[model samples]
Target: MIRGVRGATTVAENNDVEIIKATDELVKEMISKNHIAATDVAQVLISVTNDLDAVFPAAALRKIEGWSFVPVMCMQEIPVPNSLRKCIRVMMTVNTSIPQENINHIYLGNAVSLRPDLKAE
Candidate 1:
């Protein structure tokens, strides 16, 4: 069965380095927490707030080894009123035997406020 690993993180600024660094950190933490290897990831869809356009989150993900083969796409998040700012959210499709309930969803940095109910244990 396929499982989805969801995560979100906020970048301090809209720059290539900061966008890449923040995304890399969030992706790493999500993968580690879910025990997912790059080989298991089928694809990743990344959406960033409108204010963030310096770099694509997928580009940052490519900086990780073994991530080159995994299909990744980037889009702009809807700028809803009162929504989180400088936020980049990722939904990763993975080929895994684990059930959906057991999948770990990660929210880091200021993005943590976006999903407080699933706050990491």
Candidate 2:
């Protein structure tokens, strides 16, 4: 079976270092919480708010030891009026047997307000 694990995080500024760091942290947490291996990931789709464009979030995934071959794409998030700024979002599609409701969706930093219902404990 295939499932999508979602996650989002915010960075303090629109810089390459900060974007990479936050993306790495967010993806790692999502993988850890879901007990997913790099090989299990089919693809990763990342999006950043309009204010964040210093770097492509996919760069962070490539730095992971076993994620060199994992397909990744980075794009800009829709500029919704008055929406959260400096936010990075990720959706990882993986081959898993875990039930939908049991899958962990992580939201960190100020992004937590984006999805309070899925906030990790």
Best by lDDT: 2
Give TM-scores for every candidate, taking all chains together and pairing residue i with residue i: 0.94, 0.97
The TM-score, computed over Cα atoms with residue i paired to residue i, of candidate 1 is 0.94
Reference-based lDDT, residue 80, model 1: 96
Which residue pairs does candidate 2 place in steric collision? Answer: none
Q: How many residue pairs clash in all the candidates, one count each?
A: 0, 0
lDDT of 1 by residue, 5-109 (tens): 899999888999999998999899888888888998889999999999998878878888888999999999988999989999999999888788787889988
Supply candidate 1's per-residue lDDT for 2. Answer: 86
TM-score of 2: 0.97
Superposed by TM-score, candidate 2 places the C-alpha of residue 86 at a distance from the truth, in angstroms, of: 0.4
RMSD of every candidate to native, in Å, equals 1.0, 0.8
Worst 10 residues of 2 by lDDT: 112-121
